[model samples]
Target chain A: MQGSQFRLEHGKKVRLANMDPNETGSLHDREEAEPNIERLKERLEALQNMLYAEKKQSVLFVIQGMDCSGKDGVVKRALGGLHPQGFQVHSFRTPTEEEEAHDFLWRAHRIVPAKGMIGAFIRSYYEDVLITRTHKWISEAEVKKRLKHINRFEKLLESSGVKIVKIFLHISKDFQLAKLRNRLTDETKRWKFDKNDLVERESWSAYEEAYEDVFKQCSTESAPWYVVPANHRWYRDLAVLQIAVDALESMRLAYPASDPELDQLLEQLQE
Target chain B: MQGSQFRLEHGKKVRLANMDPNETGSLHDREEAEPNIERLKERLEALQNMLYAEKKQSVLFVIQGMDCSGKDGVVKRALGGLHPQGFQVHSFRTPTEEEEAHDFLWRAHRIVPAKGMIGAFIRSYYEDVLITRTHKWISEAEVKKRLKHINRFEKLLESSGVKIVKIFLHISKDFQLAKLRNRLTDETKRWKFDKNDLVERESWSAYEEAYEDVFKQCSTESAPWYVVPANHRWYRDLAVLQIAVDALESMRLAYPASDPELDQLLEQLQE
Candidate 1:
């Protein structure tokens, strides 16, 4: 029941090899968690409605994972039942020509959800650290510099009433290989399979080590990264939904107080 | 019933003096227009829901007007009924130090409504053409240069699946003076009064001329400017609501087609 146990503590060294991606705390089977997930979805929708009415703060869910780690699936299944008007999903891909002209954070900063809104970033600014470091595109010194910039950016956003929830979908290498095979064999999902994924798979341990560094460096008290056990899709969805609902509930959101003058104005309009 | 007359044709010369701010076109009384406004609001909400579900084109309402010409009121009364989750209001005041460092359109470009969202800018980038030119802050050549930039910026947004609706809330000089007087006398509204408003009042004719040039130079077939008569608040709201509903309806938005595998997935979840 304590979701915070999954949060990577700030300043602590992370060993991804030691963490179990298949662990489902306190749940023996998917059947036991199914009804609870349904209940959490309803709670999320209600909380999202109040957040929109309150119009004071926003929540940002940053979902990052390797290929076939179910980042997109989690968003579609765990969060899809909420009102589309309040919830927006932004998938960050290769930077465009115009986007490259600015600093790395510029594009991400511009689209952070405004007050009374919920936004999810499927593979977010973290890519600059993960892919670039994994490919040796940036020096270790440069990676360190970018990590500081990211921390500062998150602090800036938090100061402006945005609650940042960083979730890393943790999947075993075998799970990813299986998912990739399914994508290749399934007609409906073949479009999702990319040959480049194989190239990245060769550096799986490097990516995991890089993510461990991200956990150790970027996790903060205000915006901590949660490592969700994502080998099981049902457990992944349920755990992520629970974490999201808990984050918003911690904000203590409520509708703005009604003005007495508006009541008088309503009477005039009716008359 | 015809709203097309309010749309300024691209490349046409606009004379603000010739356009009547008091005209309600074919409607003689507020009672006659009240029902139509209600109907349009309902239509707008329905269309907006589908637009959000479709997640394709975005809408930007650029509202510009003289002081006390009901820009804020129009957004509240005309658009207030729409879901706050999908509707966002951004009031552009003086540029910040960081904003001033970039091109004039940089801040605005960063915040244009994303797909399936509606964004309203109370005073938009057009302020560069209107206020700066009226006060002689920039040279005539510079004004011409910025106008060209504004047009290109808007064209960029339009090409990216954004439907831009430029509205000028047209109010007469006498109406403005009366509103200023009321702001001074009304205790609840006194906070809204600015001494600079009176100083800007001296340049009313200059602002009109500047806005006329903006209409002539920046208006395009894709995103035309509409001058809404604003002496009558009810009529102004009705006209704006009608124009917005028509603009969205023209987009012909629909929910994204359901996936064929969704039914099977739903059954799996239920089991």
Candidate 2:
């Protein structure tokens, strides 16, 4: 229930300066949170099974964060327990020419989860507003127009029974520098280091401002955005798991109504 | 080591009558196999990380079997340990209208894993030979022609740094019957029982004959088909996990060569 505190209020003027990326409410360390994390993971897996059986609704976790914010880690640790057959993860990176030729949402719209499945999008369509705005790729008027279109597109998906949970894995500037340093020094992790990440790190403040603007404009009641403190890896995974279980539980998922015909089929199968 | 026994020799005539679905090598029970399965899973994870780091080669596992042969279950239990970001599973069901218009390999070619990723096709192009031949959907000559094309297509993938490990989950007819009965009788599992599966059960022998023909024709040295005994779920998972780990290990996965520049970047960050 404490995960609800991170939900940015709809239409509120949001600011990243107010959040503590190291905040792990009431939990001291990974040891304390391990049991609860396991419990919530089981709950999530069970709820996902019911959702798959019902075939009525789907859940999408929209994960957005800077390079070291652990967007990929959260998905692997939290949502990975769902039956892989019914779970999918799509990471949105630099768009291709074909994707750019279409509208901004074209690439994302193509990969939306069907009913009875859970999907996690890493670095999702929000990058259009966050990265594009920070880089000044589109005009201010166009950015505002695109944000409006995004709100409407999400609303359309909500109407069609897609429950969206948007999360921003908030990590501090100091933490990112440490991560980059660690990546460079660790022989095994050196492969993950991209020099472009250093280039983007220069626009840190601008990216924050851009993301704050997005939070204010598009965080709706149906699909609210949660800014999670992600510096503490264990707490971040636990919080995301809680948030996922809460979202699926709220859907009131149930198996489809039992059919008497199945009983007849069972009798025949026995024979 | 025992998993190799299941590998049907390339171009050799394969017959279901010569094998037992309940074979578990020397292991007697699930408890005995659990530790080996766990070890293979960890080996698979480590090898996968190396493969992702190398980013030079990809591995594809082509899974095929009868309807109740546990194709979906094998994917979840055996290969699900993989990092979700680098692992993709695409189940090939009935093709779309456009897919039917194109060559049989088109739908499959599009989804093959790029460098440093692993892909599993639950039912693959071999279905063109097996099901199409069994149902008389294609002429006998056409089936043979398609099998030849499949051989060439797989060879092309192999030559281009793709390691293919094809698996057949060989469950017995009585085993499938028990599974069907369980699906109908179990309230929670009733959703999985399709009426058409029972309809297809009538052509069980035809499907077996078709699969044997495919094994004899398309199972080549570079991508030999493994006819795994899948009656015992525990043994099935263990065998598949061993096959996957062995395939990845055989690739000689290694991290990319270290760059001299990253250490310089690390010092600059320290400043």
Report the number of the highest-DockQ candidate: 2
Cα lDDT tens digits, model 2, B233-256, are 999999999888878878888889
Give chain B TM-scores in order: 0.96, 0.96
Give lDDT tens digits, candidate 2, residues A44-157.
888988999998899989999999899878878877677777888888988999998999999999898889988889998889888888999889998999999999999989
DockQ of 1: 0.04
C-alpha TM-score for every candidate: 0.55, 0.97
lDDT of 1 by residue, B1-271 (tens): 6456679988889898988899888898889999999999889988987787777899999999999999877887788666555666788899999999999999999889989899989899999989999999999999999999998888899888999999999999989988876755554455456668868988999999999999999888889999999999988989899899989989988766555564454344345
- DockQ values of all predictions: 0.04, 0.63
Counting clashing residue pairs in each candidate, in order, gives: 0, 0
| Native contacts recovered, each model | 0.00, 0.49
- Tell me the whole-model lDDT of each prediction, alpha carbons only: 0.85, 0.89
Angstrom error of the Cα, residue A261, model 2: value is: 2.0
- Regions more than 4 Å wrong, model 1: A265-271, B1-271
**Chain A: TM-score in each model:** 0.96, 0.97
